[model samples]
Target chain A: MLEFDNTERTNLGELGEFGLISYLTKAVEINEPSTLKGIGDDAAVLDFSNKKTLISTDLLLEGIHFDLRYVPLKHLGYKAVQVNLSDIYAMNGTASQITFSIGLSSKFPLEAVEEIYQGALIACKKYNVDLIGGDTSASVQGLVISVTSIGFADEDQIAYRSGAQEGDLLCVSGDLGAAYVGLQLLEREKNIFLENPNIQPDLEGKDYIVERQLKPEARRDIVELLAKIGIKPNAMIDVSDGLASEIIHICEASDKGCKLYEDKIPLDSMTYETAREFGIDPTVCALNGGEDYELLFTIPQADYDKIKGSMDITVIGHITQASEGCQMISKSGKVYPITAQGWNAFKD
Target chain B: MLEFDNTERTNLGELGEFGLISYLTKAVEINEPSTLKGIGDDAAVLDFSNKKTLISTDLLLEGIHFDLRYVPLKHLGYKAVQVNLSDIYAMNGTASQITFSIGLSSKFPLEAVEEIYQGALIACKKYNVDLIGGDTSASVQGLVISVTSIGFADEDQIAYRSGAQEGDLLCVSGDLGAAYVGLQLLEREKNIFLENPNIQPDLEGKDYIVERQLKPEARRDIVELLAKIGIKPNAMIDVSDGLASEIIHICEASDKGCKLYEDKIPLDSMTYETAREFGIDPTVCALNGGEDYELLFTIPQADYDKIKGSMDITVIGHITQASEGCQMISKSGKVYPITAQGWNAFKD
Candidate 1:
């Protein structure tokens, strides 16, 4: 868990809105050639030329989306950018720019805000995306972050969720369930910390799961690798609301059903072992646990040969006729209908 | 003042996030030819072709930016879109698409959200812009709205705030200060209502100011008019932050000074009278009170004749050498330095 130092606190009111904005964004450097105008303007201007411009937005509310008690502000900032960029990459586009609007109460110090921006800047630098423009305002309660990511892709390179065809192989990048299990670990640590303030978080041996929860990366590499191998996914989506939920989305959009294999579902040993320790089924966690920023896509059967040998890619399912219904064939050879048990914000 | 009907309240939790989003966006129709793909996809794709893309975002927090006691949800939603689109118009670009992400607590009913979306749809239809994409999430507290507007303009036609020259004439579209004074009226009525719950609001003849405050429109017409007249602004900004603040921004960005005449400051009669009624200086209100959403721009002195006869356009001032400094010449011949006392969110 991250601990905030209160010794060097500077009130946000002292800088005012414009002063604070200028201070936070002073180091923003435009790296994209398409960015014609960035900060200090009414709007950011971009020259996409003949390429199609791609835009996606996500809203992260403090209590609903995250808990700052265990999550570091810098990690939160980085994760927010990753979550939005995942959408752009899911479209098979090159993520180029993002407008990050934030609303925070006066309870936060200037240094706290600086840490958030620092993390965002680091993510932007790594992803080669420009922080073009955004809005900042004081909120009445907890912090709210709204990120709108912009990208560009040729017409032929763009992939939509509705493009999936029957018999197409469903592939996912990286491993799943780690981020979800990581959150469970964080929540448990948070409860222990709240019960006893002096106890250090016992997250020493769970670095992989903890990092997956705190600083998840978007599958920009998966999009690039596909382009490099000359394989375009018929349908694509980022695994945000778990594999089951995202599969349902693709199926519903494409008017097709999917047959996912329980045995083929990739799970990290740490995630599986951690889930078992918590008395949770590892398969259920892999199916319903969300927040894995991996790319879940469907490629033609002909293209499977190119990705089969790749360690990062896993073929977990295949598209089926709509009449067949979405189902998961368990390791025991029992088939069960897939249901969207993913995280629901409105659930009490 | 707007009164929400609580007689028929449907809990937002019933719809969940996806259900709520689908319910709200069921009627969204794509009107922009540039928009290749809208909502339902990972990202909205827009084919801007050779035109440069203009992107701007604004975040509005419930308690910080508005008071729900007097501001209607529909009007609030409409004003939010107008506020973002004004930025695009400020750049002499045509707004064609917007991604509106909103975060609201469970206290809000489904109908209230529908009212907000209804208002947003009305604005989108009027502006000929597409509600391309967005994110919906449950907030821990009050409503949070973030709108990212996208537009397009030819490379040569786009106006930058740093393009102003010494000899350029400062021009403003539409009258000023009405919205600020209107807000004063609403606040007074709100306080009265809070103290005496049985009393009705005494806003008999304040329709103009009230409407200005509740539902201000972006000056898209002014941008179109300038284009029609074949005049391009050297520098431009929207008057979301009072005239003085916006003027200072233009001056600082262009590395020039400005001479704004006090008498030339456009003010509606209702705004002037209301300011006096509140025992406030109308000029100060025009200089400090914001949310006018009018376009403030600078054109070459030679292009003055084309706009001089237009009633909508007002020649308020002229650009000067950097050493002259940005100043306002009062009617009494006294010169005062322009200061940005505009709405600062950080101010307590």
Candidate 2:
């Protein structure tokens, strides 16, 4: 759990909405050439010229999407931005700008909001994205964050989820299930701490999993690497709702089926061991666990040689005709239809 | 007040996130040629060719930014889009697309959400804007709505708040203060109904004022009319935060001062009569009541004749040197410094 200083409790009402907006955005610097106007305007102006503009948005609410008791304000802000940017990257576009809006109750101090903006600015700088515009409001209850990310790409270079064809190789980047296992560890420690405040969290040698949950990164490197290697995926999407759910999305959008090989799925040793300790199958976690911001795409067979021998990219499945249906081939030589057990916000 | 059918409660959880997304977006149609790709993709794609892109966003929360007790779901959705589009129009741009995100608790039925979307689609159709992309999630408490609007304009035709000259004419579109007075009428009726359930709302002959509060319209016509008259505003902003606050923003951003004549301020007959009944000054309602969504702009004095006969546009004041400061000249020829009493979301 993160520690916050309660001594500095400055009420948000003192600044008012306009004063608070000015104070919070004073540190914002515009670096994107497309951004002609940033904050302190009725609207932000951009010049995308001939490139196709990509837009996506997400809304995250407290208690539903996160728990303030365990999640730090800075990490929450960083992760919120990363998740939105992941959508743009999934379209094979270069994210260049974002608009962030937040609604928080008066219970939060000025310093707490500052921390959130600090973390957001850090991520924006690292990714070379401009913080162009946003809206701020007071909520009646807990915190709320809404982000809209904007990106650009040449029309011919953009990849859509419906562009996949039969006989395409399904590829995934890095490993999965780490973020979900990390959450399980955090929840366990939270329960223990609630039962007895004196017992510290036993998170020794668990840094990798914990970090995965706290600060998941978007796969910008994968997009950049593909451009350098001259390989354009036929279809692409980010693994936000677990590998199984995202793969299903690709198949349905493209009107095709897929055969996912269970043995070929990449899993980090720590994620596997942690899931085992929690009495959960690692493969189930990999297939159903969400929040792993990895990239998943399909490449044509002719371009397979271009991505072969890459350590980060692994071929986990192959697309098939619609008649075959989407299936998962287990290591035991048994085939089962793939169903999405992805996280649903409405579920209790 | 609005009535909802409680007998048609369809649990939102029955349809998972993906299923819900598909069901909600099935009606979305792409009408803009610029929109290469719309819903069903990771991100919406648009090509604006050579025009500068304009973007703005707004966050609306229940019980704070709005009180759902008297707001109809349909009206709320319509007003949300208008308010965000007002920002783009304030920049003298033509709004083309929007991305809307919402969060609601499980207590809401699927039909309730459909009503909101119905209102949003109506607004989109009327404004000639496309609903490109969005995200929906279950909230832990009351409803939340966030909208991001996108538009386009030539670089030279765009108006920035910092471009006002010292001697520009201060002009405003349409009358103000009705929306504020309308809210008072609704609150009075709501209190009476809470104390005595059978008491009917006495809103007879008050349709004009009430509609102003529930369904405000953005001044897109003013932007187009200006282009037709061959007059470009030196600086412009929308009156979302009342007349006084918006003018103050213009003066501050341009590093100049303004003299607003109280006698020239536009006030509707219904708004004036209603404020008198409520035992409040009508001028205060116009100066600081907010939510007008009218356009406030400044143009060179040489173009005054071009707009003199237009009934909708009212010339209220003129820009002054920085040493003059922002002041209001009352009808009695008394001068007073203008202070911003605009609506603050953080205020209780």
Report, in order, each candidate's fnat.
0.86, 0.83
Cα displacement (angstroms), candidate 1, residue B230, comes to: 1.2
What lDDT tens digits, residue by residue, belong to model 2 across residues A1-348?
568998897788888888889999998999988888898899999999979999999998998888887889999889989999999999999999999998998767888988888888888998999999898889996899999999999999898998888999999999999999999999999999999989998889999998889889999999999999998999999998899999999999999999999999999999999999999999998899988999999999898988897999999999999889899999997999999988888876
The DockQ-based CAPRI class assigned to model 2 is: high
TM-score, candidate 1, chain B alone: 0.99
Chain A: TM-score in each model: 0.99, 0.98
- Model 1 Cα lDDT, one tens digit per residue, B1-348: 478888989888888888998999999999899999999999999999989999999998988989898999999999999999999999999999999988988778999999988889999999999999999988887888999999999999999999999989999999999999999999999999989999889999999999999999999999999999999999999999899999999999999999999999999999999999999999998899999999999999999999989999999999999999999999999999998987767778
Query: Residue by residue across A240-342, what tens digits does model 1's lDDT show?
Result: 8899999999999999999999999999999999999999999887778999989999999999889988999999989999999999999999999999987
Q: Under the 3 Å rule for N, CA and C atoms, how many clashes does model 2 have?
A: 0
User: Where in model 2 is the C-alpha error above 4 Å?
Assistant: none
| Clash number by candidate, in order | 0, 0
What tier of docking accuracy does candidate 1 attain?
high
**Candidate 1 segments exceeding 4 Å error:** none
Give the TM-score comparing model 2 with the true structure, all chains together.
0.99
